[model samples]
Target: MPADSQPASREKPSPAAAPAAPGAGLSAVQRALRKLGLVRDIDFALYLPMRYEDETRVVRLSDVRDGEMAQIEVAVTSNEVVFRPRRQLIVTVDDGSDTCQLRFFNFYPSQQKQLAVGARVRVRGEVRGGFLGRTMMHPTVKAAGTELPEALTPVYSTIAGLAQPALRREVRSGLARARLDETLPAASDWQPAWDLRRSLNFLHYPAPDVAMATLEDHSHPAWQRIKAEELLAQQLSQMQARNERAAQRAPVLAREAGKESLAEQLLAVLPFALTGAQRRVGEEIGRDLAREVPMHRLLQGDVGSGKTVVAALAAALCIDAGHQCALMAPTEILASQHFGKLVDWLDPLLRSRGLRVAWLTGSQKKKERDEMSAAVESGEAALVIGTHAVISEKVRFKKLALAIIDEQHRFGVAQRLALRGKADAGLEPHLLMMSATPIPRTLAMSYYADLDVSTLDELPPGRTPVVTKLVADHRRDEVVERIQAQLQQGRQVYWVCPLIEESEAVDLRNATTTRDELADALGEAVGVGLLHSRMPTAEKQSVMAEFSAGRLHVLVSTTVIEVGVDVPNASLMVIEHAERFGLSQLHQLRGRVGRGAAASACVLLYSANEGGRVGEAARARLRAMAETSDGFEIARRDLEIRGPGEFLGARQSGAPLLRFADLATDTHLLDWARELAPRMLAEHPQLAQRHIDRWLGTRAEYLKA
Candidate 1:
């Protein structure tokens, strides 16, 4: 059932921010159900069981085996409250063959009365063997003479105040009332053995004779149908978003013939030539901008791949067409880096044409912000670059044609839409989003299906490969000696800590303490600076400036410097508790160095727990970092480790779009969906729209931006 098909009284809230239903005289259970995003019959119909309970038969107590889940029928012989370790209620039950003890650490008065001595009851739980014979820590008790269920009982995931029985009743009612009409045409080639209605019915209450293993691992035919439908819905929604955008109008930024375009001029003035990959992607973007429709292209490359130069070229092209371009970065440090690089590359060229570059940030003083806003509004600033402040309501654009977002995954859906909404009325600006964290192929096909992707697969010439090494925490002294060696050679170093200050929750190194320690270790002659998120904006800028100017020998900071801070003189990176960081983050931090021709190295200093070893997942991340420097490979391994939700970060607004189909293991199904979606939309437009509405509803908005 589509959300739009529900009654008009229901409110649609995102899963993460699910609030109480907007109505009078609602029960606590109803409110709790709303928190789970179950406001519609379809929401309940799609909320499948996490697991099932076997209530089809009862086994004798003598036949119950240890380490196995079983239901046994017995009479309660004794019940008492005991307090040895703690207060508990213990009931001893016996059949003709054997006796078992049922313990409950917490019990209510109703439960006590129901389990009175000599009462017959049927209990279900995991059987465990102990000194007192067979026992169940907490068994579910029920009347003994009731008829067994024909099918397995579903155990749904629910919030407090909504018990499993209550939820089961609601799910059954919703399933009966939901509209399960066939959305796919009968002639579809991708049809599964089970239809949509049959799949949901079988999944919600499976037959007792079915293979539990297949159901648990989601390998059954019913599960396959569900995953296929989900994948198809996602594909349809993304295709719809793309088709709708094609109908909108945007500025045609094609270059004029017989005139040297701004991009060509910038290319001529660049100190370094563009790599083959850069030129290829640049051409791809150039073609998109030339079209009448808005360009929604993603530019992805590894760190040190010279993405900044490509972005500068794109900006130049936009400016050459007599339109404004805005570049937005997530953090101030990264935004400042882009600001400095763009100013150096285009400031003189823009000034020659009576145009200038403007910078804006949240930390800017009132007068500075006002000046930047005025320049932007007056169209004097042909190229604007800043942090989130660039999207502020006060900063209006004049003829905004293109918007470039760096590290786009760090931004939320609302933020990206806000930037895109800054364009003039009746027109949208072409979007060119750049990311240093290369997106894997599967991820690109699914999450980014709506946009064209351009990949800079190769780094620029003369980039040194950084050697990665893993060291235990006990070897901190040796890492210090290595840093000293770099300093001795007139090179700089970056010591990155996970935490900014002392934290009682985490027992890891802090930036402040590390800075002090390194300052004392290297003596007062060496200039050591500390940088973190909590520091004042001016202080962070000053510290980075000093480091870039070679006045600071070492810079100790947090992951704030992980992405875009560049210093050619820096040759070494030491990450404290590297096990605490993600694979992409570690790769980005290592990329901070190795920009210049100097040979660089990254040291991953990690600590072990009381068991004398790091966690398995953490070990995998460290091992992957040491084995490969390829951003694509790291992203692949990262997807395998963290799944797509964490890999995409805030891109999905904290809710993973695909709940059934997995991009990694279900590639075949995903390919089928991708192939069928376009055809369905073209041949059976009504069915495609209904399918998207039924599966996505309000959640489809996340993909549009």
Candidate 2:
């Protein structure tokens, strides 16, 4: 279950147990409601129908179309119970125009009484045609001459043991009991034509006259109102979090007067000059670090944009201010890569100042971990770099002032919070989250509104643009020949597989098998290495080291090297079963190449499934890869295919995503909400809080971390 859908109260009862309130105990039905997150009356009111059924008019049996849903009034001519394939109840009915058959695989004793011979009844269900004529496998039966409903009957999304009629009754009761007063200001121009109660009532059971297209597309006035209100609540919560963080204190990082700053010193000694985009974002982070208010910033850059160097500059400023800094990545390979680069750049600089960089990871030996923990506690490690081990309970920072997270979306809310919580008492460390998978524009506007964002839009000079190609798995031999050619040019290759071992469920090439096959095809003269998550830590490190040092001609691995594996000499990346990977993963894997001046290429080797071709969704991902190398474009296309929830990863771990409003189509509403959120909070603070409470409740608290 989702965190928001769990039970409302978890407290134990007192020994003397007070009298229980009406409907307080969790009956089967109540448990079902709790599963739907319908704890309060307002929650039930908002649980609108997923679709509606039209039973307002009856159609003649002769006029019903095959595979179309219809209702007809007819008289039963024969009713019989038969056993064929299985025991079932079959009823033959005839209207004035024609006749039809009704079959029920599961039926109650009372249903037979309702459909007795010579009885008139009304049935509603899908009609299917066969040699025996039209039939409804299981139709809803009702007495004839009964009054038809004036509005469309709603069919709600439900769980087991809860029928639609029972849910309808509870929804009607809750709708009447829920609060429906307006929360927006009276002068707000963004409000739709309909009021809150009218919108909810109409959406629950729309009139028969309403256009089906309007309801299906959610373009009706009532739906517009619901979407607007939902967007407003989200914007308000984000605004509140931003305002609350503004009041908190953090370490004030500033260079000493009349002295060269460490950031400047590091920049002066670098082998390459900083790109304009990197220099601009570096200054932006530098300004934020000098503030007393803790900086909540997101640094977004495309692959190979020189983000690591900019991060190093920020760490230098924090250290120069007489405080320690820590950087965390999601995987050991990425962490080791960052550790190597930081050590190469800042180790000598820090050693000259009586401080050094430290490394920590779960795979480290006990003695090494203990030594690193002590150095962190004593403030001797000016810069600490590692995977999640940096935030482990055993590690403590004496005066940590900056916390940087690479690939921030890969970590959960609690993990990120735990790192921030490592700061000194009554103060927070400035947070800098970095992501190479660029967030789309609308996503940053809504999901990341609380944090300031800096984009590294330009790659450094001398970086080659990678050419992408799509090939069938049948052409594997041709790809091997291309790899040989690249090796002949003294260039390395990365062959990424989707799996490490053969699985009965998924029939794809594994890293180990691919490694052995490639080594044989390329001759023993070409060295091949295999890297995956299941490999021992030291062994994995050794394989990567060999690849980086130009000792290995081809490295076959899983996505463990998706990010932070910077091998400039490696100019070819072949992804086997590329259709099995997400767009972001495909893009990130492709980025591992094209880091050097040599022309690079990424071959997407895909195989058709049992259906004779890959799925349409997978085709779109592959097409996107072949069409462009722009990370932002890929992200936008990805959002369209996968939706926002999966793209966010663990960032919204306990938070409820937008249920009604769409970030793709509701940008106008989002804009209106953004404009009104701060004003409403300033003028009608109570109403603002009440609005958030009604829609988000405790779910909004997740965004605070």
Task: Write the residue-wise lDDT of candidate 1 on 316-404 in tens digits.
Answer: 98999999999999999999999999998899999999999999999999999999999999999999999999999999998899999
Error of 1 at 648 (Å): 1.1
Model 1 global lDDT (CA atoms, 0 to 1): 0.89
Clashes of each: 0, 0
Q: In candidate 2, which residue pairs get closer than 3 Å at backbone N, Cα or C atoms, i.e. clash? A: none
Best by TM-score: 1
Clashing pairs in 1: none
Q: For this target, which candidate reaches the highest lDDT against the unseen true structure?
A: 2
Cα deviation of 192 in candidate 2 (Å)?
1.1
TM-score of 1: 0.95
CA lDDT, candidate 1, residue 129:
98
Task: Indicate the residue-level lDDT of 582 in model 1.
Answer: 89
